[model samples]
Target chain A: MKHKPRLPQGLLTTGSITLTVLVLFATLPGYASIYTVILLAAIFMYIVLTLSWSIFSGPTGYISLASAAFLGTGIYTSAIFGKMLPLPVVVGIGGLASFCLALLAGALTLRLKGIYFSMFTFGLVELIKHLMLWFEINLTGTRGRFVIVVDHITVYYVMLVLLALTILTAYAIRRSKFGLALQSIGEQEEAAAHTGVNVTLVKVSAFAISAFFVGATGAIMATRWTYIDPYIAFNYLFSFMPVLMAIFGGMGQLYGPIMGATVFAYLEEILITRFPYFYMLFFGIILIVSVLYLPNGLAGLIQGWQKRVWGARYVHP
Target chain B: MSILEAEGITKHFGGLTALSGIGFHVDQGEILGLIGPNGAGKTTLFGLISAALPPDRGVIRFKGEVITGLKPHQVCRRGVARTFQSVKVFPNMSVLANVMVGSFFGRPNTVSAAAAEGESVELLEFVGLSAFAAIPARDLTLANQKMLEVARALATAPELLLLDELMAGLNPTEIGLAMDLVTRIRDRGITVFMIEHVMKAIMCVCERIMVLHHGEKIAEGTPKEIAASKTVVEVYLGESAYA
Candidate 1:
């Protein structure tokens, strides 16, 4: 017997609300303050990074700390080729460069499990950063390069499109058979392999796909910073922030990381402006408290509240 | 004709030999019981056949084609599937989804999602887990989890199914049910090779039994012949007792 795919309740309302928000975002440059547009663009970047990170790490349980490597690849691509190529072409090439790097790196190191895999990826950022620094010092005789600056409005629009694409990709993957295979791999890798899932291929491909978005985001965001060196481009914060945001948001559902990044980024902005010295202190405290109390993150907390409020009426399928 | 043949199968872990020059052949459409004491390399042999682990020195053939060096997934697609000795269900996935993984990727050809889902449900029903289809697999009892593993293996549509200690943790009633399930599975025309410690269930269900002692095949024959075999009896109930 044939069965229709089941969607969760209130998806229609959520879709409409998202569409309305997108419309507002699309038209924001006309009325909103320049600062607000720039701030929102930063928020969008965080969302893309977190969502992309989750697309691979969330389902497959492969925690990679190589976001900076991919992002740096994009930033460097833009720094080197920004003047030579059109903006779209530069961004595409940046993404493709990271994709290839991830493909190579994934094939080599994806065999390592748990903390070993994570450590290898973490070391990858340092490796790339140092290698780039050495290349600049020896071959190019340059420490850093100035990226061609695009207007704030253009940067905002590009980020928004990338955000939309990342979301769509994440959502599509979460619902597809491929997503099921990823989840199974996370649950039991050996069993998944024995059950006919090509564990290595699925893992390496997912890792590479995730890097593409981070690279693309870095390509666009590079314009915001006119001058960048290896250290600036490959800062480890870009790697850890996505993981933190995803944990805070929850990885169980598609909206979790998005909500986490948006709220977290907005909070960071407000705290930095209000109390620059104490902002990081407060942030650390809040993260610790959330980690301790909210084991499943915001999504799980929301799910619990919904179950209590709606009783048996709410089915979370 | 034998559906699976392993010749000169030897495996070593550093200094310890898991299996030494082991050889066996399982006939097509027969339920063959592999019984041995703890660490006789019964599961190791299964791992070798299913390509979970490679043998250091051996040739394994399925349908007369060497399958020794293939990946686990490749072996599975070539119609050999296995259940783990310790149940390995996808804990967070629903019971039906656990089975659906097999249906979706087990065979050589791609299966439509709807068809896979339907087949999964039917397999779940076959294993009496239809009632728990929506529940996460981890929430099921150990016996039920093993049943889910069986259902999942069956979803792969394997011609040769390797069941490793399927009845180990089962109670007497569950053991009876499991024995019946094995017979039913054999009747479906799939070759069954099982590693089992539960003598009653294994003896009643398997058409032929192979005895292993310290990684060597001590005896191989029908259940009655095995029961009367001197070496097989001595290996299980120490030689001093018969002496």
Candidate 2:
């Protein structure tokens, strides 16, 4: 019988820590205040976005700013179908819609590399937002739509499921042959192609897969809003926040984005509640400091210290 | 018998004709060297055969099948693989992972992870990079990086390999090892089409040599005949000799 490959020690430690935290959070609603439950739900949403964004952009260095486009598509799907279908089916359709949109967008613009790719992806958000706006103004005869509301507990549970799925998918892809192709493409696309990677197909498929998570999260979160307009659904902050969180946490390990999104979301919550007027100013300062000093992100900073303290013998390098 | 053949290969980058009417064939299990002065379109010809760039006019046949207009990855899957003029190893990946990428995706059939890893390890040993398999590719010396690229290309299990300027930046010792590696590769039944600027390495290792000048083929013969050709000496060797 073939032996199963042993998991790396680092991965095992990380996996256990993740499971512990997940179990704690899974039971939090029973004992904690509703405020804590809601806040955790919001944190889960950010984690899903940041983790999914890193799934594609982290390894490929594509720097996509198109999360809002997919998220908004999911929001709209939920708005249109919330009353007709059940929650799970609606979320599935939302994810599928975003996947299709991403496939078309990726195939068209992935040929453009570096900053050009970023610009095109950012432009995709604005294009979709305006297109939805025009459709609402001209054809729908309505500007905003109401969504069917789910209980806060149900919303929290769904968000938890999504967070789990995103983590699992991201982890699985990162350890697979497909993930190696993505990294190779990022390092040297021409060489990767000559080495037998179908660069276009890999790029497009990853783009769509990442979008699936963002879309599903958006679908679940839409129920909490109860009503969403194009502006609310397609906010550009959704596009930028995930990128920042991933960078702040670290892009090196799977937990890097998870750590980043958790800290960033918590900070945002605290700032908005206590220092509403100056929250963004403080948030901006923290982001700048992290970018300037923690070049490798939080995980990298920790890894660096581990190497120094242990004299390189303790580290894998 | 020829394993790879190209005819009437022409490419134009705007107004500059990079390659024009270039015809060549790589005999099975032979090392065919291509040499020329700067801007002779040597790399461009490799690009056309490997499908990195399209030929405005040409038909390329591999194993008696037309492969003209196929994508680079498609060409690779058909058993043709290439290394870039400049080393293009995936810098952030481990040396073994770099080769694994090739073994996993280079073939028509899918490769299991364990099988890919085993093949990658063997290729790394073949290229004398077995000791450095776990280190990131960017940490390797330039010569070692070139060897890593060779290992990666070989992991694709190619029947025909195209190497562009494999010894351009290497020292004399490194060049000797690279030449030895090429011969070893040929002995293993892989046809090698190489572009080289090192006259000694090319003359000693290759059975036949082709010369290009101003995007056109100038001479085609055995290494001895090419060395004795007045036209080649006048245009290429003479310039190098003066320098």
Candidate 3:
């Protein structure tokens, strides 16, 4: 009999920690006050967005500003289908719609590398957002929809499930051969191609998979507002926040963005409450400092320290 | 018999001619050396053969099958593999994981995780990188990094291998070892088509050598014949010899 490959201690430790956190959050709704619950729900939405963005942008080294486009797709998909089908089915359709957009966008934009891809994606979102508005305006002479109200607890639970799914997908992809291919693409696209990675296919599929998570999350979270327009649905804030958080956490590791999201989320909460006028300035400063001094972000430091302790070098040149 | 054949292969980057009607073949299990001056299109030829870039003219046949326009990954799956002129190891991955990426190429029959590990370990050991397998690739010395590249290319289980500048920046000791590795690779039934600036490696290792000048083949012969050629001496050697 062949010996089973031993699981890395790091993976196991991280896995347990994640499970513990998920369980803790699952139970928090019961004991936490309504304000805390609402904040937690928002935080969890950020987590899903961060995870989803990281799924494509992290492993592939593609800076995507199109998360909002997928989010908008989900919002519209949910708005149209929420009353006709069950919540889960509506969310599923929203995810599929986002996947299609991702697939199309990936095919068109992934050929451009580095900043070109970033610019094209940013442009794509703007184009999509405007197209969505133009279509909405032409069809209804107005550009918003009334959504079916879901129970707050149910919405919270659904968001939890989405966060869990995003986490699972990220973990799975990071450890799989597919993730290897994507990582290779990120490191060196031409070399990766020569090394037998299907650069185009991997890039496109990663885009679709990343979009699937954000799409679902957006759809499920839509009921909280009960009315969403292209403005709110395709909010550029959703597009920028995750990219910054992923960068701030670290792009190389799966947990970097999560750490980034948590820290930034809490930091934002404090800053906005205490110094509302200067909060944006502080946020911009943090981003700039992290980009300049800590290019690998917080997780990079933690990973380096861990590696040094274990006698392995940090995984960057 | 020829394992790889390129005929009338031409490439141009805009108006600049990189390779013009370049044609050559690598025999089965032979260490064929390609020597050229800087910008002589030796690396470009490797790129064309490895399918990293498409030829603007002519066809390439690998294992007697037309593979002119195949993408690098597709060509790789068809039993052609290569190393880069500049080391392109996945710096963020573990040393073994870098090799594992190669092992996973071409529909590796490693159905189980253990089997995959075993295969990667074997390739790592072959390239003499087994001891540092747990370390990330970025930490390795320059020599070890080159060896890691060789191991990764070998992991593809290629029938034909294109090694670009494998001996570019190495000491005599490392060059000797690298030459031995190339010989061992050929002995194990892999055809090695290599580009080398090191005359010592070309003279000692290659069974046949082809010289390129300005993207065109200027000479092809045994090492002695190449060494004796008036054109080779004037164009490539130009009064330099290493003991």
Candidate 4:
């Protein structure tokens, strides 16, 4: 009857792996080439994005595509304010702006379930993108707001720290009472309500937390580029890619998004370098095959294999 | 003291009347049986009382507090827990974890995961599902799934437990076990409100019976009185042969 894992072996293993990765990442800039550092920074950005998606949408099955809404809010906040403020302050503003947007969206759409919820969230990004474009043509001239570009190495270290914080926060949430409540809502909203879970409160809080993460990533990344148009800031690519990567890695587990982001980021870099014109086509083909074979994501495939070899002994919750 | 009091409870779904002017009271520690033919408003009545749906007309009181318009979770927090007519276990979670969710969310005194787990294990044992605690709920047999539902519902520590057809697909032996479990639940000081099609179990176990026909309360009495009532027999005969 007592089936509690007194100490979570899976969590411990995940924590140790995360720690090792963190240590290695911290030491990278000392000896690694500038290209390696830049590439890793971009990879770290991807990890933050995918994990942000996973933390809210993965366990809850909400299928939110509102990342660009949050991401663009952050980017534009930084773009408009970066020149007058400190880098950390600008990033904080970006995060706050995105969190505000999430509160608005969660209030309006958290009642929607399944495919309707997905479409509404998908529409949210599009809504933000178009509104920004409209504002630019009607008021602000063709050129978008100017940005303050920080040094690449400083940006790199900041990204590493942000990525670590996002993951640690995500891991902590997955094990907390908040995590359990959201996941219960994910599994069965009615049942969760019946069990005394404050469904609206849990969901709205999760939405804001996820938005804060993506917003911070977007705010920091916005300064790295020379141009800051609505097109660049509110790219649909950022909106959709994190979702796909999280699904690929196994959204069910906390570490799943990290694995997905890492693999896809490197694969993207290699394909762009080698295939140039045909990279997306190759990416599409590879992604299709992986999704078809590993329906539960890469983590699921690994779990299934581990279960077979280990004879199904104490699989993680 | 009455655990539940319903007055003039009525529900309509776009002109289809589900319940109308149905009044009932379930006393503390009473085992009340609810029976009706399909579309007889039994489940609809349950839904209104449990706060899954709001009544078009009437008031529902639980432990003397007006709970008619409360949300389902609010109702649960006030000590009402229910099982679905269909098996509604959290499929991906372990049986123990599934029960733990209820205790963790529904019990104010359970402050830690370990405490919830210990309490949930006890509930699981009470419902005879202790051996399957670590297994995912999806893998359980339907009969055991019913038992798991009871354990999960019990984890809420409800003053009134509304069981929606817990014995529908159960074997005869399983039904016997279920009957015993229901009695034990009452013995543990929880009021029981159950909807059942198994006449033998309902007749033998419930202290009283309420029959609904076309959203109207046509009969309310002890099991033997219900069996002998001409209106009850006529209502069942109009729909189909009574089980």
DockQ of each: 0.79, 0.71, 0.52, 0.64
Docking class of 3: medium
Name the candidate, 1 or 2, with the larger DockQ value: 1
Residue A4 Cα positional deviation in candidate 1, in Å, after optimal superposition? 6.1
> Interface RMSD, candidate 3?
2.5
Per-residue alpha-carbon lDDT of candidate 2 for residues B80-105, written as tens digits (9 for 90 to 100): 99998888999988889999999999
True contacts reproduced, candidate 3? 0.70
lDDT of 2 by residue, A1-317 (tens): 00135458866998799899889988989999999999999999999999999999998999999999999999999999999999999999999999999999999999999999999999999999999999998999999999999999988999999999999999888878889889899999999999999999999999999999999988989998988999999999999999999999999888899999999999999999999999999999999999999998998988899988887766544
lDDT (Cα, tens digit) per residue for candidate 4, span B64-169: 9999988888888789999989888888778887888788887645457777888888999999988998888999999998898888888888999999998999
Give Cα-based local distance difference scores for all models: 0.92, 0.92, 0.86, 0.87
Question: lDDT per residue, candidate 1, B1-243, as tens digits?
Answer: 999998999999889899999888999999999998898889999999999889999999999999999999999999999999999999988888999999998899999987998999988888889999988899999999999999999999999999999998899999988988988888889999999998888778998999888888888999888877888887773564344
**Candidate 2 stretches greater than 4 Å from native:** A1-16, A308-311, B239-243
Q: Looking only at chain A, give the TM-score of model 1 against the true structure.
A: 0.96
Q: Please provide, for model 3 over A132-213, each residue's C-alpha lDDT reduced to its tens digit, 9 standing for 90 to 100.
A: 8999899878879999999778888888888888888888787688888888888778877877778999999999999998
Model number with the top TM-score: 1
Task: State the iRMSD of every prediction, in order shown.
Answer: 1.4, 2.2, 2.5, 1.6
Docking class of 1: medium
